[model samples]
Target: MATTLLLAGLMLAQSAPAITVEAQPGLDQVGYQALSAGRPDLAIERISADPVMSASDPAALINLGTAYARTGDRTAALARYKAALTSRDRYDLELADGRWLDSRAAARLAILMLERGKALALR
Candidate 1:
Protein backbone atom coordinates (compact mmCIF):
# COMPACT_ATOMS: atom_id res chain seq x y z
CA MET A 1 0.00 0.00 0.00
CA ALA A 2 2.80 2.41 0.92
CA THR A 3 4.68 1.73 -2.31
CA THR A 4 1.53 2.17 -4.38
CA LEU A 5 0.82 5.55 -2.70
CA LEU A 6 4.37 6.69 -3.23
CA LEU A 7 4.32 5.74 -6.87
CA ALA A 8 1.00 7.49 -7.37
CA GLY A 9 2.31 10.63 -5.68
CA LEU A 10 5.40 10.58 -7.81
CA MET A 11 3.36 10.17 -10.94
CA LEU A 12 1.10 13.05 -10.00
CA ALA A 13 4.06 15.29 -9.33
CA GLN A 14 5.67 14.38 -12.60
CA SER A 15 2.49 15.18 -14.52
CA ALA A 16 2.25 18.71 -13.12
CA PRO A 17 3.22 21.55 -15.37
CA ALA A 18 6.39 23.46 -14.61
CA ILE A 19 5.95 26.84 -13.02
CA THR A 20 7.50 29.70 -14.93
CA VAL A 21 8.33 33.03 -13.37
CA GLU A 22 6.44 35.68 -15.27
CA ALA A 23 7.93 39.12 -15.86
CA GLN A 24 4.71 40.92 -16.73
CA PRO A 25 4.78 43.69 -14.15
CA GLY A 26 8.51 44.19 -14.29
CA LEU A 27 8.47 44.09 -18.05
CA ASP A 28 5.66 46.62 -18.14
CA GLN A 29 7.59 48.96 -15.90
CA VAL A 30 10.74 48.48 -17.91
CA GLY A 31 8.83 49.09 -21.12
CA TYR A 32 7.45 52.39 -19.88
CA GLN A 33 10.80 53.49 -18.50
CA ALA A 34 12.60 52.59 -21.69
CA LEU A 35 10.05 54.38 -23.80
CA SER A 36 10.17 57.45 -21.63
CA ALA A 37 13.95 57.35 -21.63
CA GLY A 38 13.94 57.03 -25.43
CA ARG A 39 15.48 53.60 -25.34
CA PRO A 40 13.21 51.22 -27.20
CA ASP A 41 16.10 48.81 -27.74
CA LEU A 42 16.50 48.30 -24.01
CA ALA A 43 12.78 47.82 -23.59
CA ILE A 44 12.79 45.23 -26.35
CA GLU A 45 15.67 43.32 -24.83
CA ARG A 46 14.35 43.47 -21.30
CA ILE A 47 10.92 42.20 -22.25
CA SER A 48 12.22 39.61 -24.66
CA ALA A 49 14.44 37.96 -22.04
CA ASP A 50 11.52 36.77 -19.94
CA PRO A 51 10.99 33.00 -20.17
CA VAL A 52 7.24 33.47 -19.95
CA MET A 53 7.38 36.07 -22.69
CA SER A 54 8.43 33.73 -25.45
CA ALA A 55 6.48 32.73 -28.57
CA SER A 56 4.29 30.50 -26.46
CA ASP A 57 2.96 33.29 -24.26
CA PRO A 58 0.45 35.35 -26.14
CA ALA A 59 0.69 38.30 -23.82
CA ALA A 60 4.45 38.16 -23.81
CA LEU A 61 4.55 37.70 -27.55
CA ILE A 62 2.36 40.75 -28.03
CA ASN A 63 4.56 42.81 -25.77
CA LEU A 64 7.63 41.60 -27.59
CA GLY A 65 5.99 42.47 -30.89
CA THR A 66 5.19 45.95 -29.67
CA ALA A 67 8.75 46.40 -28.56
CA TYR A 68 9.94 45.31 -31.98
CA ALA A 69 7.54 47.72 -33.63
CA ARG A 70 8.69 50.56 -31.38
CA THR A 71 12.23 49.80 -32.43
CA GLY A 72 11.20 50.04 -36.11
CA ASP A 73 11.37 46.30 -36.57
CA ARG A 74 7.97 46.01 -38.18
CA THR A 75 8.60 42.66 -39.81
CA ALA A 76 9.77 41.02 -36.61
CA ALA A 77 6.96 42.58 -34.63
CA LEU A 78 4.33 41.26 -37.02
CA ALA A 79 5.94 37.87 -36.95
CA ARG A 80 5.81 37.73 -33.16
CA TYR A 81 2.19 38.83 -32.97
CA LYS A 82 1.18 36.36 -35.68
CA ALA A 83 3.12 33.67 -33.90
CA ALA A 84 1.25 34.54 -30.72
CA LEU A 85 -2.04 34.19 -32.53
CA THR A 86 -0.94 30.91 -33.98
CA SER A 87 0.17 29.60 -30.62
CA ARG A 88 -3.11 30.63 -29.11
CA ASP A 89 -4.89 28.66 -31.80
CA ARG A 90 -2.73 25.57 -31.63
CA TYR A 91 -3.18 25.22 -27.90
CA ASP A 92 -6.97 25.10 -28.36
CA LEU A 93 -7.07 25.81 -24.67
CA GLU A 94 -10.10 28.10 -24.84
CA LEU A 95 -8.42 31.06 -26.51
CA ALA A 96 -10.21 30.68 -29.81
CA ASP A 97 -12.32 33.62 -30.90
CA GLY A 98 -10.00 35.81 -28.80
CA ARG A 99 -11.11 34.40 -25.43
CA TRP A 100 -7.41 34.05 -24.50
CA LEU A 101 -5.78 31.38 -22.35
CA ASP A 102 -4.59 34.19 -20.13
CA SER A 103 -6.70 37.35 -19.84
CA ARG A 104 -3.76 39.53 -20.80
CA ALA A 105 -3.17 37.87 -24.15
CA ALA A 106 -6.10 39.37 -26.00
CA ALA A 107 -5.56 42.83 -24.62
CA ARG A 108 -1.87 42.76 -25.36
CA LEU A 109 -2.52 41.49 -28.86
CA ALA A 110 -4.92 44.34 -29.50
CA ILE A 111 -2.44 46.90 -28.27
CA LEU A 112 0.41 45.36 -30.19
CA MET A 113 -1.61 45.22 -33.39
CA LEU A 114 -2.48 48.88 -33.06
CA GLU A 115 1.15 49.69 -32.48
CA ARG A 116 2.05 47.65 -35.52
CA GLY A 117 -0.21 49.81 -37.71
CA LYS A 118 -2.86 47.10 -37.92
CA ALA A 119 -6.42 47.86 -36.99
CA LEU A 120 -7.98 45.18 -34.81
CA ALA A 121 -11.29 44.08 -36.18
CA LEU A 122 -12.46 41.82 -33.43
CA ARG A 123 -15.73 40.20 -34.22
Candidate 2:
Protein backbone atom coordinates (compact mmCIF):
# COMPACT_ATOMS: atom_id res chain seq x y z
CA MET A 1 0.00 0.00 0.00
CA ALA A 2 2.80 2.39 0.92
CA THR A 3 4.55 1.56 -2.34
CA THR A 4 1.41 2.38 -4.33
CA LEU A 5 0.86 5.65 -2.53
CA LEU A 6 4.52 6.57 -2.95
CA LEU A 7 4.31 5.96 -6.70
CA ALA A 8 1.11 8.00 -7.01
CA GLY A 9 2.78 10.82 -5.07
CA LEU A 10 5.79 10.67 -7.33
CA MET A 11 3.58 10.71 -10.45
CA LEU A 12 1.62 13.63 -9.00
CA ALA A 13 4.89 15.47 -8.39
CA GLN A 14 4.47 16.85 -11.92
CA SER A 15 1.62 19.12 -10.67
CA ALA A 16 -0.70 18.96 -13.65
CA PRO A 17 -4.48 19.26 -13.42
CA ALA A 18 -6.12 15.83 -14.09
CA ILE A 19 -9.75 16.71 -14.64
CA THR A 20 -10.56 14.52 -17.63
CA VAL A 21 -10.37 10.84 -16.92
CA GLU A 22 -8.93 8.86 -19.85
CA ALA A 23 -11.68 6.37 -20.20
CA GLN A 24 -11.71 3.28 -22.43
CA PRO A 25 -14.89 1.93 -23.97
CA GLY A 26 -17.25 -0.61 -22.35
CA LEU A 27 -17.72 -0.64 -18.58
CA ASP A 28 -14.92 1.86 -18.13
CA GLN A 29 -16.67 4.30 -20.43
CA VAL A 30 -19.91 3.68 -18.61
CA GLY A 31 -18.21 4.48 -15.33
CA TYR A 32 -16.83 7.78 -16.61
CA GLN A 33 -20.20 8.71 -18.06
CA ALA A 34 -21.86 7.94 -14.76
CA LEU A 35 -19.43 10.12 -12.84
CA SER A 36 -19.86 12.90 -15.36
CA ALA A 37 -23.60 12.59 -14.84
CA GLY A 38 -23.10 13.33 -11.12
CA ARG A 39 -24.02 9.82 -10.05
CA PRO A 40 -20.89 8.71 -8.27
CA ASP A 41 -22.67 5.85 -6.54
CA LEU A 42 -23.76 4.43 -9.87
CA ALA A 43 -20.32 5.07 -11.25
CA ILE A 44 -18.78 3.05 -8.47
CA GLU A 45 -21.24 0.26 -8.94
CA ARG A 46 -20.74 0.18 -12.68
CA ILE A 47 -16.95 0.09 -12.54
CA SER A 48 -16.53 -2.11 -9.54
CA ALA A 49 -19.02 -4.62 -10.89
CA ASP A 50 -16.90 -5.34 -13.91
CA PRO A 51 -14.27 -8.00 -13.19
CA VAL A 52 -12.08 -7.00 -16.11
CA MET A 53 -12.18 -3.35 -15.14
CA SER A 54 -11.11 -4.08 -11.56
CA ALA A 55 -7.98 -5.72 -12.92
CA SER A 56 -7.04 -3.89 -16.13
CA ASP A 57 -8.51 -0.42 -16.52
CA PRO A 58 -6.35 2.24 -14.91
CA ALA A 59 -8.86 4.90 -15.88
CA ALA A 60 -11.63 3.03 -14.13
CA LEU A 61 -9.46 2.73 -11.05
CA ILE A 62 -8.81 6.46 -11.03
CA ASN A 63 -12.49 7.13 -11.61
CA LEU A 64 -13.27 4.93 -8.61
CA GLY A 65 -10.87 6.99 -6.53
CA THR A 66 -12.60 10.12 -7.73
CA ALA A 67 -15.99 8.72 -6.79
CA TYR A 68 -14.83 7.71 -3.33
CA ALA A 69 -13.23 11.07 -2.75
CA ARG A 70 -16.35 12.82 -4.02
CA THR A 71 -18.55 10.92 -1.54
CA GLY A 72 -16.28 12.11 1.33
CA ASP A 73 -14.75 8.71 2.04
CA ARG A 74 -11.05 9.47 1.93
CA THR A 75 -10.08 6.01 3.12
CA ALA A 76 -11.85 4.43 0.16
CA ALA A 77 -10.39 7.01 -2.15
CA LEU A 78 -6.87 6.26 -0.98
CA ALA A 79 -7.44 2.57 -1.45
CA ARG A 80 -8.59 3.13 -5.03
CA TYR A 81 -5.51 5.24 -5.79
CA LYS A 82 -3.30 2.54 -4.38
CA ALA A 83 -4.97 0.00 -6.62
CA ALA A 84 -4.53 2.29 -9.65
CA LEU A 85 -0.76 2.40 -9.09
CA THR A 86 -0.54 -1.35 -9.42
CA SER A 87 -1.22 -1.13 -13.16
CA ARG A 88 1.86 -1.73 -15.27
CA ASP A 89 0.86 1.06 -17.64
CA ARG A 90 1.75 4.53 -16.42
CA TYR A 91 -1.35 6.56 -17.24
CA ASP A 92 -1.08 10.35 -17.05
CA LEU A 93 -4.31 11.90 -15.89
CA GLU A 94 -5.02 15.52 -16.87
CA LEU A 95 -8.37 15.99 -15.18
CA ALA A 96 -10.90 18.56 -16.41
CA ASP A 97 -11.82 21.46 -14.11
CA GLY A 98 -14.97 21.10 -11.91
CA ARG A 99 -15.91 17.99 -13.85
CA TRP A 100 -15.40 16.14 -10.64
CA LEU A 101 -16.44 16.85 -7.06
CA ASP A 102 -13.29 18.92 -6.79
CA SER A 103 -11.59 20.74 -9.63
CA ARG A 104 -8.97 18.03 -9.95
CA ALA A 105 -9.08 14.51 -8.53
CA ALA A 106 -5.48 14.01 -7.51
CA ALA A 107 -5.22 17.61 -6.35
CA ARG A 108 -8.31 17.14 -4.23
CA LEU A 109 -6.80 14.03 -2.65
CA ALA A 110 -3.62 15.95 -1.91
CA ILE A 111 -5.61 18.76 -0.33
CA LEU A 112 -7.61 16.30 1.70
CA MET A 113 -4.36 14.74 2.88
CA LEU A 114 -3.06 18.15 3.91
CA GLU A 115 -6.23 19.08 5.75
CA ARG A 116 -6.36 15.77 7.60
CA GLY A 117 -2.59 15.65 8.13
CA LYS A 118 -2.73 11.87 8.30
CA ALA A 119 -3.46 8.58 6.52
CA LEU A 120 -0.93 5.82 5.94
CA ALA A 121 -1.88 6.15 2.29
CA LEU A 122 -0.58 9.73 2.26
CA ARG A 123 2.75 8.68 3.68
Candidate 3:
Protein backbone atom coordinates (compact mmCIF):
# COMPACT_ATOMS: atom_id res chain seq x y z
CA MET A 1 0.00 0.00 0.00
CA ALA A 2 2.81 2.43 0.78
CA THR A 3 4.46 1.76 -2.55
CA THR A 4 1.20 2.26 -4.39
CA LEU A 5 0.50 5.58 -2.62
CA LEU A 6 3.99 6.83 -3.23
CA LEU A 7 3.76 6.01 -6.93
CA ALA A 8 0.43 7.76 -7.19
CA GLY A 9 1.75 10.87 -5.44
CA LEU A 10 4.75 10.99 -7.73
CA MET A 11 2.57 10.69 -10.80
CA LEU A 12 0.29 13.47 -9.61
CA ALA A 13 3.20 15.74 -8.90
CA GLN A 14 4.74 15.07 -12.28
CA SER A 15 1.46 15.69 -14.08
CA ALA A 16 0.69 19.06 -12.43
CA PRO A 17 1.22 22.01 -14.72
CA ALA A 18 4.07 24.27 -13.76
CA ILE A 19 3.09 27.83 -12.88
CA THR A 20 5.24 30.84 -13.61
CA VAL A 21 5.09 34.55 -12.91
CA GLU A 22 6.26 37.38 -15.12
CA ALA A 23 9.58 38.98 -14.24
CA GLN A 24 10.89 42.40 -15.19
CA PRO A 25 14.50 43.43 -15.39
CA GLY A 26 13.84 46.83 -13.86
CA LEU A 27 11.66 45.60 -11.00
CA ASP A 28 12.76 45.84 -7.39
CA GLN A 29 14.72 42.68 -6.66
CA VAL A 30 14.11 42.99 -2.92
CA GLY A 31 10.36 43.02 -3.45
CA TYR A 32 10.52 40.10 -5.84
CA GLN A 33 12.63 38.15 -3.41
CA ALA A 34 10.13 38.87 -0.64
CA LEU A 35 7.30 37.59 -2.78
CA SER A 36 9.20 34.45 -3.71
CA ALA A 37 10.04 33.86 -0.07
CA GLY A 38 6.28 33.81 0.70
CA ARG A 39 6.41 37.06 2.61
CA PRO A 40 3.55 38.87 0.97
CA ASP A 41 3.49 41.74 3.47
CA LEU A 42 7.16 42.38 2.97
CA ALA A 43 6.78 42.17 -0.76
CA ILE A 44 3.97 44.69 -0.67
CA GLU A 45 5.92 47.05 1.53
CA ARG A 46 9.07 46.90 -0.55
CA ILE A 47 7.27 47.13 -3.84
CA SER A 48 5.09 49.99 -2.70
CA ALA A 49 8.04 51.93 -1.37
CA ASP A 50 9.27 52.44 -4.92
CA PRO A 51 6.23 54.16 -6.30
CA VAL A 52 8.02 55.49 -9.33
CA MET A 53 9.38 52.11 -10.36
CA SER A 54 6.24 50.19 -9.51
CA ALA A 55 3.85 52.67 -11.09
CA SER A 56 4.63 52.27 -14.77
CA ASP A 57 6.07 48.77 -14.78
CA PRO A 58 3.58 46.09 -15.70
CA ALA A 59 5.85 43.46 -14.28
CA ALA A 60 5.79 45.17 -10.93
CA LEU A 61 2.04 45.30 -11.10
CA ILE A 62 1.92 41.58 -11.69
CA ASN A 63 4.22 40.94 -8.77
CA LEU A 64 2.11 43.14 -6.53
CA GLY A 65 -1.00 41.35 -7.67
CA THR A 66 0.61 38.04 -6.84
CA ALA A 67 1.57 39.29 -3.42
CA TYR A 68 -1.95 40.52 -2.79
CA ALA A 69 -3.36 37.22 -3.89
CA ARG A 70 -1.11 35.43 -1.49
CA THR A 71 -2.51 37.57 1.29
CA GLY A 72 -6.12 36.75 0.37
CA ASP A 73 -6.84 40.25 -0.87
CA ARG A 74 -8.67 39.23 -4.01
CA THR A 75 -9.93 42.71 -4.80
CA ALA A 76 -6.50 44.26 -4.72
CA ALA A 77 -4.97 41.39 -6.63
CA LEU A 78 -7.57 41.51 -9.38
CA ALA A 79 -7.16 45.24 -9.72
CA ARG A 80 -3.43 44.93 -10.19
CA TYR A 81 -3.79 42.06 -12.61
CA LYS A 82 -6.30 43.98 -14.67
CA ALA A 83 -4.03 46.98 -14.82
CA ALA A 84 -1.15 44.82 -16.04
CA LEU A 85 -3.32 43.06 -18.58
CA THR A 86 -3.90 46.30 -20.47
CA SER A 87 -0.26 47.20 -20.80
CA ARG A 88 1.20 47.28 -24.31
CA ASP A 89 4.77 46.85 -23.15
CA ARG A 90 6.48 43.56 -23.88
CA TYR A 91 9.07 41.79 -21.78
CA ASP A 92 10.99 38.55 -21.87
CA LEU A 93 9.29 37.38 -18.72
CA GLU A 94 10.54 34.16 -17.22
CA LEU A 95 7.68 31.68 -17.21
CA ALA A 96 9.06 28.50 -15.70
CA ASP A 97 12.36 26.92 -14.86
CA GLY A 98 14.51 28.40 -17.63
CA ARG A 99 11.44 29.04 -19.78
CA TRP A 100 10.34 32.47 -20.98
CA LEU A 101 6.97 33.99 -21.81
CA ASP A 102 5.61 37.33 -22.87
CA SER A 103 4.63 39.61 -20.01
CA ARG A 104 1.13 40.13 -21.37
CA ALA A 105 0.55 36.41 -21.65
CA ALA A 106 1.76 35.86 -18.12
CA ALA A 107 -0.63 38.48 -16.80
CA ARG A 108 -3.53 36.87 -18.62
CA LEU A 109 -2.68 33.47 -17.23
CA ALA A 110 -2.42 34.85 -13.71
CA ILE A 111 -5.82 36.49 -13.96
CA LEU A 112 -7.40 33.31 -15.24
CA MET A 113 -5.93 31.21 -12.49
CA LEU A 114 -6.98 33.67 -9.82
CA GLU A 115 -10.55 33.84 -11.07
CA ARG A 116 -10.76 30.09 -11.14
CA GLY A 117 -9.91 29.81 -7.46
CA LYS A 118 -6.40 28.62 -8.25
CA ALA A 119 -4.63 31.63 -6.78
CA LEU A 120 -2.48 29.23 -4.79
CA ALA A 121 -0.93 28.06 -8.01
CA LEU A 122 0.51 31.52 -8.52
CA ARG A 123 3.80 32.62 -6.95
Candidate 4:
Protein backbone atom coordinates (compact mmCIF):
# COMPACT_ATOMS: atom_id res chain seq x y z
CA MET A 1 0.00 0.00 0.00
CA ALA A 2 2.86 2.42 0.86
CA THR A 3 4.64 1.67 -2.44
CA THR A 4 1.43 2.22 -4.43
CA LEU A 5 0.83 5.56 -2.72
CA LEU A 6 4.39 6.69 -3.46
CA LEU A 7 4.11 5.67 -7.10
CA ALA A 8 0.77 7.44 -7.38
CA GLY A 9 2.28 10.66 -5.98
CA LEU A 10 5.18 10.48 -8.42
CA MET A 11 2.84 9.85 -11.33
CA LEU A 12 0.67 12.76 -10.30
CA ALA A 13 3.68 15.04 -10.14
CA GLN A 14 4.94 13.85 -13.51
CA SER A 15 1.56 14.34 -15.09
CA ALA A 16 1.29 17.98 -14.17
CA PRO A 17 0.03 19.92 -17.17
CA ALA A 18 1.99 22.74 -18.73
CA ILE A 19 0.35 26.12 -18.82
CA THR A 20 -0.27 27.60 -22.25
CA VAL A 21 -1.23 31.16 -23.09
CA GLU A 22 -3.34 31.88 -26.14
CA ALA A 23 -2.58 34.72 -28.55
CA GLN A 24 -5.05 37.45 -29.42
CA PRO A 25 -6.57 37.55 -32.87
CA GLY A 26 -5.66 41.19 -33.43
CA LEU A 27 -6.91 43.24 -36.39
CA ASP A 28 -6.54 41.58 -39.76
CA GLN A 29 -7.46 42.48 -43.34
CA VAL A 30 -11.04 41.49 -42.69
CA GLY A 31 -11.16 43.81 -39.72
CA TYR A 32 -9.74 46.65 -41.77
CA GLN A 33 -12.39 46.08 -44.38
CA ALA A 34 -15.10 46.27 -41.76
CA LEU A 35 -13.69 49.48 -40.41
CA SER A 36 -13.44 51.04 -43.87
CA ALA A 37 -17.00 50.07 -44.58
CA GLY A 38 -18.35 52.53 -42.01
CA ARG A 39 -18.58 49.96 -39.28
CA PRO A 40 -16.17 51.37 -36.75
CA ASP A 41 -18.08 50.05 -33.78
CA LEU A 42 -18.27 46.56 -35.22
CA ALA A 43 -14.63 46.70 -36.16
CA ILE A 44 -13.75 47.73 -32.63
CA GLU A 45 -15.75 44.85 -31.20
CA ARG A 46 -14.15 42.30 -33.50
CA ILE A 47 -10.60 43.56 -33.08
CA SER A 48 -10.93 43.79 -29.32
CA ALA A 49 -11.84 40.11 -29.28
CA ASP A 50 -8.45 39.10 -30.61
CA PRO A 51 -6.80 36.91 -28.00
CA VAL A 52 -3.22 37.75 -28.99
CA MET A 53 -3.47 41.53 -28.78
CA SER A 54 -1.68 42.28 -25.58
CA ALA A 55 -0.52 45.82 -24.80
CA SER A 56 2.48 45.21 -27.04
CA ASP A 57 1.32 44.98 -30.66
CA PRO A 58 1.55 48.53 -31.99
CA ALA A 59 -0.42 47.71 -35.12
CA ALA A 60 -3.29 46.35 -33.11
CA LEU A 61 -3.06 49.18 -30.64
CA ILE A 62 -2.97 51.72 -33.42
CA ASN A 63 -5.97 50.18 -35.12
CA LEU A 64 -7.87 50.21 -31.88
CA GLY A 65 -6.87 53.82 -31.33
CA THR A 66 -7.99 54.71 -34.83
CA ALA A 67 -11.31 53.04 -34.26
CA TYR A 68 -11.83 55.00 -31.09
CA ALA A 69 -10.81 58.16 -32.86
CA ARG A 70 -13.33 57.55 -35.63
CA THR A 71 -16.04 57.27 -33.02
CA GLY A 72 -15.02 60.66 -31.55
CA ASP A 73 -13.58 59.01 -28.47
CA ARG A 74 -10.53 61.19 -28.16
CA THR A 75 -9.65 59.92 -24.70
CA ALA A 76 -9.55 56.29 -25.75
CA ALA A 77 -7.78 57.14 -28.99
CA LEU A 78 -5.05 59.06 -27.18
CA ALA A 79 -4.58 56.32 -24.64
CA ARG A 80 -4.27 53.67 -27.32
CA TYR A 81 -1.91 55.79 -29.41
CA LYS A 82 0.24 56.48 -26.33
CA ALA A 83 0.39 52.77 -25.62
CA ALA A 84 1.36 52.10 -29.25
CA LEU A 85 4.13 54.68 -29.07
CA THR A 86 5.40 53.19 -25.83
CA SER A 87 5.45 49.76 -27.42
CA ARG A 88 6.83 51.16 -30.66
CA ASP A 89 9.11 48.39 -31.92
CA ARG A 90 12.35 48.64 -33.85
CA TYR A 91 10.26 48.38 -37.01
CA ASP A 92 8.36 51.49 -36.00
CA LEU A 93 11.55 53.51 -35.59
CA GLU A 94 12.92 52.09 -38.79
CA LEU A 95 9.73 53.10 -40.54
CA ALA A 96 9.82 56.54 -38.97
CA ASP A 97 13.37 56.90 -40.25
CA GLY A 98 12.18 55.84 -43.69
CA ARG A 99 14.29 52.73 -43.76
CA TRP A 100 12.74 49.27 -43.47
CA LEU A 101 9.19 50.05 -42.48
CA ASP A 102 6.34 50.12 -44.97
CA SER A 103 6.24 53.51 -46.63
CA ARG A 104 2.46 53.64 -46.75
CA ALA A 105 2.04 52.71 -43.12
CA ALA A 106 4.68 55.16 -41.99
CA ALA A 107 3.29 57.93 -44.11
CA ARG A 108 -0.21 57.17 -42.96
CA LEU A 109 0.73 57.26 -39.31
CA ALA A 110 2.61 60.49 -39.75
CA ILE A 111 -0.24 62.09 -41.64
CA LEU A 112 -2.79 60.86 -39.11
CA MET A 113 -0.78 62.22 -36.19
CA LEU A 114 -0.40 65.55 -37.92
CA GLU A 115 -4.09 65.72 -38.72
CA ARG A 116 -4.97 64.81 -35.15
CA GLY A 117 -2.84 67.73 -33.96
CA LYS A 118 -0.52 65.51 -31.97
CA ALA A 119 2.89 66.87 -31.01
CA LEU A 120 4.80 65.65 -34.04
CA ALA A 121 7.80 67.73 -33.04
CA LEU A 122 8.66 65.36 -30.23
CA ARG A 123 8.58 62.35 -32.55
Local distance difference test, each candidate: 0.42, 0.47, 0.56, 0.41
- TM-scores, all candidates, are 0.47, 0.54, 0.69, 0.52
Among the numbered candidates, top TM-score falls to 3
Between candidates 1 and 2, the one scoring higher on TM-score is 2
Ranking of all candidate structures by their lDDT, best first: 3, 2, 1, 4
Query: Which pairs of residues clash in candidate 4, taking residues 3 or more apart in a chain or in different chains?
Result: 23-51, 23-52, 24-50, 24-51, 24-52, 25-50, 25-51, 25-52
Model 1 residue 65 lDDT? 60
Cα shift from native, residue 23, model 1 (Å): 6.1
Q: Write the per-residue lDDT of candidate 2 for residues 51-105, one digit (tens) a residue.
A: 7765555555666766666666767766666665666644334322212232124
Q: Tell me the lDDT of model 4 at 97.
A: 29
**TM-score between model 1 and native:** 0.47
| Position 72, candidate 4: lDDT | 62
- In model 3, the Cα lDDT at residue 18 comes to 22
The candidate scoring highest on lDDT is 3
Error of 3 at 56 (Å): 1.9
> On lDDT, who's better, 2 or 3?
3
Clashing pairs in 3: none
- Candidate 4 regions off by >4 Å? 1-30, 88-123
Pairs of colliding residues, candidate 1: none
